[model samples]
Target: MDAPLPPPLFPALAAPTDRPALRCGPDVLSYAELARAAGALAAGIAGSGRVAVWAAPTARTAVAVVAALLAGVPAVPLNPRSGERELAHILGDSAPELVLAGPADELPAALAALPRVDVELDGEGSGAVPPPAEADPESTALIVYTSGTTGPPKGVLLSRRAVAASLDALAEAWAWTADDVLVHGLPLFHVHGLVLGVLGPLRRGGEVRHLGGFSAEGVARELASGGTMLFGVPTMYHRLADALPGDPALVKALSGARLLVSGSAALPVRDHERIAAATGRTVVERYGMSETLMNTSVRPGGPPRPGTVGTPLPGVEVRLVEEDGSVLDGSDGETVGEVQVRGPNLFSGYLNRPDATEAAFDGGAAGGWFRTGDMAVREADGTIRLVGRKATDLIKSGGYKIGAGEIENALLDHPGVREAAVTGEPDPDLGERIVAWVVPSDPADPPADAALADHVARLLAPHKRPRVVRLLPSLPRNDLGKVLKKRLPRG
Candidate 1:
């Protein structure tokens, strides 16, 4: 009696095809095969409201998420590296009816109490009975947990409409189509690898080849073998830049890519230049956060410059507001202000935390604008150049507000410096003192504090120069390659 339901999130899956849809390491699946597999799995979990997926960096993880979406069930992806306390919190908060994982995956003690379903990739369902594709678009599709740096990780509820909008907008921005083959080894839990990397391609009828783990060799092999696009964070690009000189295979692979994107954190201008110099391609940087799926990205056509995240995506409105709550009118590329955005790509709210949900929407230019907490300067051409996080990256010293990112970029420009993180410490005279954490190219002979201080003073204002320089073997980073500034030693 009812009309056949429409596939909103993934219309590509409905079409008949034997083309390879997803590949993780040695495991690969065709579109038809994946549809059948997910359909079968979906039937088993149809009535289950919310499902917990152990997001292992494997093909089975992708299958679990797809099955959840097919059944119209909200799926919560648990980080594999989450500790007991964090795991317990997520499990208790979400309270999934069943946990889905690969057969070989060992369940942690926190998840051992829940009923488990092993996602079987080979399972077959009658191709005639596909999961109901039509559903309320506002229904929660995913419950992604935040990093919880301030406190316990809050769950972000992303709806089907939001997911669809984000993917379609990105497709338009990057010129992403079914013909494009995306390659990445990013973890399956995060939005970059899961939503954008896997789901983005699936929505467009494109193919994806996940390397399981990132390496220059793996990247080269995939790109050489039909991979057209690459997605990575700053750390990955840095490694690629480091390898380009010695590894001709890596150089050739990157040169062949149609598009290369960097996100999660700002890719240093030096690394961007290095990669471009080695390969005739420039790595385009995009700005996004967990709350907002994607806000801005460099245009796909050509002439993507370094250090700017380009203009806002279609259907997304971005504005800058000063600390006094005045909307920035002109794009002068100098005045720094907090970034605010409003678009369909935004999440519904923080699951079970109405207080946080309200706070996230407290201040904005136009009503309903989600405060991004990220600070940036808008260029005359409407491009966004990020300064840093408002909480940590914006440093007020000697009656002037300085962004740590600019100083960090200056430090990275030095040939002797391999990596750098700049932070502000309490100073009685200047309000806050600039501190530089340096990872030297040759740790045995680290650059002197005075030389590095002078380097910053010459490049930027004398007040922006580091008051103290501490040499380290490596900077503290998360799985996404974002610098964990809070984890840095205070002394």
Candidate 2:
């Protein structure tokens, strides 16, 4: 009676061919091989309501997820490094029918209760490739958990439409085509790695080469061997920047690539300049979160703004809202506001948490917009420059609203400062005084607090200077290189 669901998220697998689809270390799968393997697995798990994947950076992980999509079942990607308590919470919340993992993967104790299915890298399906699933486009495809900075992780229900919309939008923005080949060593748990990295390549009818782990040499080797694009976080770029000076091959490989992208956190302007100076290639930046897949990205042909994440993707509407929920009229480039977005890329809701989900969206006569909780300023050119998170990176001092990201960037420019984080602490006179936690390049001869304060005051406004400075051996960060402000010492 109802119109059939749109074609499978990955149209390349429908009529499998011998074109390369995926490569992880020594393992490789052509479109036909992937279809046969995933189709067979899909037939076996067709009725499974949901499945959990021990998301390892391996070929098996990709096959497992594709199979689940073919079966019209939701797949929950579990971070292989998640703590026991976190794992237990996710397992209980999702209540997957079984767990799919690599043949040699050693899952943690929390996954012991679930039925286990080992995904074989070389096992092709017994018969002809099965047709794609005919399920509703609105059906949940994946249940990815949040980083849970505010509280325990919540499962974000991503729909088939949302995933397809996001990938297609990115394809348009990046000028992605079937002739492209992607290279990355990111983990499989997060959307950047699994969805954008793995699924993106397949949806484009292209190939993806996963390094299993990141390395400058590995990146060079792949890019030299026909890899057109490289996807990495800031940490990975930092390493490449460090390696570029000594490794001409690395520089050559990077220079020859069609695109280099950095996300998960802001790429410091200094690092951007270093890589560009050496390789003549600028690393493109994009902004997104678990709730919304891909909001904005610097287009392939557009100006590669170093600090900005570029304009909103095709079909995505972005708005900057004030504290009182009123939308700002236009971009001034200096006025900071909370980012809100509405588009097909948005998640359906948090799994089994209606109250939380209701609170997340601010709907009005103009449709619902998901609050990103990220603070940014929209440049006059329509590009968005993110300062930081609303909760941790926005600081109010001396009747001024200062973004900690700017000050951190300024501090990073200092030759003495290696890593920096900025936070605001309560003050008797200023309400909230700025604090700078820095890791010096030379701890034995660390820069003086007053000197650093003077440097910041001169670079920015006097009021934006750090009132307190704390020297640290290193900044506490997550796996993705995002600093953990809550974990920093207050005293």
Candidate 3:
């Protein structure tokens, strides 16, 4: 006999309650209303194989995703800002049966070929909760496409067990409960914004308030009212840090927030200090990727470390391995190794890419460890500090391994530097020379190359100093505000 299936992912939706569940701008949905709306939508989309959701930051988008989960159909979240070429590739790769979008959203020409269903936030239903789909827990619940850095984007298959495990682990780490309200302005397409930000609240029987878009004023207004937590990317927090000095309301709101979390990219130590100086609250950082929902996070009541991404969540085992596949024994905080994770939070596999999926794991099929491709240093206390990606961030110069993230952080500490990114380039003598691309705080009066290089040498090591510094007006960035190092121009 086989093991029994787990209960519904969102048990709060099974019964009627007048408590608010979701809020996007002025639109609000109580638990009772959300259940009826999602049940009706689920009934219509039942047996629809796989569906796509236009993940706009709205209550309707949330309903569509919930309906798909309730009906046991997989949902592929499409980024509304994705280019036509990228969107076309994803649609062809996933081959969703239908697309679900808000009633007022105007999709681009690339989506015209697919069938669409307009989700109405205020639509009526039978006032009955839909039964959980009778399916194995290992079945796919979401197919999230990764950002295609090396090649075309591949669809990642995430199972219901993985999602549930990740959420439960996070709850234990953060001490999350039904009384906590999460406030964020993240796009609903990726795991940080969708799985943790939107679905997390629903699973915990809490409320989520999505700011149509992120703004310092909106964050202050919401947190000042009743919001308890804030989830944001580095860019969003950087803006908050910049605005906190001038906005008293923002400071008060942040000081009162139970938790302020940052992910998707590393939050600079400078930004963390600035916010703490103003609000007396420290921002917690977590590490994760598309293949792994969440591997590590700084516990809410644990020690406060600004540069590290805390310890692994409960049930997630994290290890650093050498190039020869030997696992590192102890955390010394100096040795850099590739991050490998094994846990229930791991994804099933990549959709239609068996070769890629197999390549992502190490030690054969039985190993069960997913190679994250991210490089990090484990501290003495078991905290993980991510240095950078192996492909782009690990710089081998002068017979030494150097991480670009630490150099970038040192550069940002200089008063003249506004933004910085580090990469390695081919050199005649050194195997790979360290190069620094900097955005000066003042374009009219940029810091000299010698001064900046000497600043880094004094703060870090002499060998880690940039061999060459290129000053730019601004650094190229993505929608989530991560610096696009690949797009940086080489001299």
Q: What is the C-alpha RMSD of each candidate to the true structure, in Å?
A: 1.8, 1.4, 1.3
Candidate 2 TM-score versus the reference? 0.98
Candidate 1: misplaced stretches above 4 Å? 1-7, 363-367
Residue-level lDDT tens digits of model 2 in 1-491: 97665787888888779999999998999998888888878887889989999998999999999989988899999999999899999999999999999889998888888999988755553554655456788899999999989999999999989899999999998999999999999999999999999999999999999999999999999999999999999989999999999999999999999999999999988899999999999999999888899999987656669888999999999999999999987888888899999999999999999888888888831359998889999899888999889999999888888889888988887889989999999999998999999999899999999989999999877998999999999999987889999999876
Of candidates 2 and 1, the better by lDDT: 2
What are the models' TM-scores? 0.97, 0.98, 0.98
- Candidate 1 lDDT tens digits, 164-253: 998899899988999999999999888998999999999899899999999999999999999999999999999999899999999999
| Candidate 2 RMSD computed on C-alpha atoms after optimal superposition onto the true structure | 1.4
Give, for candidate 3, the lowest lDDT window spanning 10 residues: 125-134
Give the number of colliding residue pairs in candidate 3: 0
Off by over 4 Å in 3: 1-5, 132-134, 365-367
Per-candidate clashes come to: 0, 0, 0
Which residue runs does candidate 2 get wrong by more than 4 Å? 1-5, 364-366
